[model samples]
Target: MSVPAWLARGVFRVQEAAMRRPTFAMLAELERTQWLSRSEMLDYQTGHLNVLLQLALAHSPWHADRLQAAGLADAVRAGAVLPSDLPRLPTMDKRDARDNVERLVWRGVPGGVFPYTTGGSSGEPLIFYFGRARQAADAAGRLRARRWWGVNPGEREVYLWGAPVELNKTDRIKSLRDRLVNQLLLNAFEMSPVRMDDYLQAIRTWNPRAIYGYASSLALLAAHAEARGIRPRLDALRVVSSTGEPLFPHQRELIERVFGVPVSVEYGARDAGLMALQAPDGSLLQMSETHLVEVLDAAGNPAEEGEAVITSLVSAAQPFIRYRTGDVVRRSGRADPGGRGLAVLDAVVGRQTDFIVAADGRIMHALAVIYVLRAIPGVGQFKLIQHAVDRLEVQVVPDARWNDAAREAILHGLRARLGATLVVDLNLLDTIAPEASGKHRYVVSHVPLHGALAQAVA
Candidate 1:
């Protein structure tokens, strides 16, 4: 190992030793539970679910009233809450989370509360709270998934994702900490051809064991690499994991062919935490230890094809009890091929948000603009149209929450992303129609990507 690698490992060991016992124990426990039988796994999930529900009742009056109203309170009080019996509770949507955030938070939670905002895929910004367990659930579950791909924690890995452009002092410190963990963060938002080449070279030098990025962004990079006849020979590379957007079949083929590594899919949301990961055996296994995934039809009936109603077992600090995720998923009839006993899903059916371009020629993930609009309260539903590098049109469907200040906030946000000179026109709409595909994407970029190479060279 290099000197820096040795130093990173040393720092990691010290940090691990300083971690709370409960947090460390949880990570250790997942290693064993992943191999349990299906029935045993279900029981294990229910055990955590029951504990979360009790915590919700004790801390969050909003969830407490719902459980009592739905007649699920008695069963929970009697300690008879079963994994199979969760559907008796009412389902929650983003609106409930947005409006009742305070009521839903368990402030006195162990390790305290953490506030976070979702970069909305459905154009609905939701601010939610989480605690230590939720954070550990995401990180440790991902570590377990990496092990499935023959990679371990502290192993060299590359993150191809959007980064905060303006980093404060705290952000810089976090970046240093990230480097100490043997991880590199590449800017996924700006992927001009020249930068892609630089990124490929960086990968060759770093020799990351695994590559993780947005599905579309990785595919775009692979396409660019193929176009330029650049096939990087990274011997240490093991897996290429795609996330934040659905992995289209063609995109998957392109990525696999270019990277010379197996491609895996990760399905998760900031609010929901890590839900599922594509196992090495090709099964999309729900992280059943941390979440309870339910596919419910429009009528709230259990169905093979429907929206994913998630009950996050780790989200006790802000219990997302039977929350409707607005994500389309089809439950798989196939069993776990790896026989790890985790729940399986056939596919995640969702449209990939298009990449956006800034006035300064930064190619950002669609979530960058989505993050701006969704974080604003008066924005009931929004659609961002990037007409040019320096111009944007935002179509917002305001509910009863509409206000004039939202317009200025929207303009300020657009300028921040596209540039100060960018023209932003906000149009208030009563409704925004879905595409011919019947899916409503929060962001659409009409600005062509043909000039990416030229922009990069400039």
Candidate 2:
């Protein structure tokens, strides 16, 4: 259905305000209360599951049918269902969720639904619905993290992101509005060596209190500055937060060393909002009050630490129950130690789409290669591509700092991780190309579908 232009503009304005106002404050309070409450963690999980189930039955046809099919219509009558009952429900894949967007979307309510699109990093573009209330709650969670670095809304902020843009004549007005809002917009697609130099100068001149952007882009800037022996004074900035991709330990260390600020890391997906954030003590804490997180094993049962499955508690417009996030995270410890209840994300591996299978049925993630190759002294940029089940290719762009020892270290690391039986080939290249989304994938598998083999691959 076509929406009126004025209505669309009004929706955008409402969403922007909700993302930056009193709603965020309420969300922070709710998160604190939930963590401090004396209730058992299992009871909290069941309560949230029932809430989401009720919302699904009321609004989302996709979820309604799935629940009915599993004979769960009465199970959610009074929020008394057991945790063991959740496994009886069917699993929903990304394609299934995307195909039924209309059934999942609610319309004509002030804070009912918001349309969003994915970054298409996996070569799959999708549009989904999110409730404004949940979106506001998510905004609040982000603001709570920002508080760790002394950032406040309405203060001057700079955003460096990778969203698609139209550089038309209309950009003049948009630029003016951005400046009026005390915000600066930098495109991620235009990051070259020269462009990065200009960005550094802009930061030094504007001197915003906080800087937020993709971790990879910022790491590139730090590397360039280190190589050129140019250190710009950024004393005005209190914090630096990196999102949109996994922030490597080496990158975080380098950024902190160069900028002289604490580096905060966060994780999120476009379909949902912020999932987890690094606390002051360096633990990645899940937003338990606003969302429910599950770490499932290969058998689709709850694992002590495995793949992350999310069930958004506040999204009434489109319920995301037991939705696989394609991310691998391990549970930090037993749930609800003491009265403080929060799921701790111990570690995050690469995407489920980027796993490589070995002949012995072991699965290896892309970060394994990154952890090894990044330790090599002279490696500037690297990419690993898997052409078959047991064959892999490694491409590296070397800097002047690399020597024979660096190459040997990389080779040895690969052999150790993939086992000496697998074929490991290294190719020296001037540059490594990024994916279509302007992000790099550390691993790519081209093998056709095979059930058990696929499980082994992941």
Q: Per-residue alpha-carbon lDDT of model 1 for 1-458, expressed as tens digits?
A: 22365677567667755653243466677888988998899889878888988888888999999988889887887778997788778899998998888889989987888888785566767778988888778877887888899987778888898744422334767777777888877877667667888998888888888999888888888877877887878899999999988888778887888889999999998888889999888899888899889998889999999999999988988999899888899998877878787889999997567888877667777877776787787888888888888888889888676787888888888788778998888898888788787777788888777633222211
- TM-score between candidate 1 and the true structure: 0.92
* Cα error of candidate 1 at position 305, Å: 1.4
What lDDT would candidate 2 get against the real structure?
0.66
Report how far off residue 455 is in candidate 2 (Å).
32
Candidate 1 stretches with Cα past 4 Å from truth are 1-10, 13-23, 163-172, 398-405, 451-458
lDDT of each: 0.81, 0.66
lDDT of 2 by residue, 388-420 (tens): 767878787777777999888877877776667
Superposed by TM-score, candidate 2 places the C-alpha of residue 384 at a distance from the truth, in angstroms, of 14
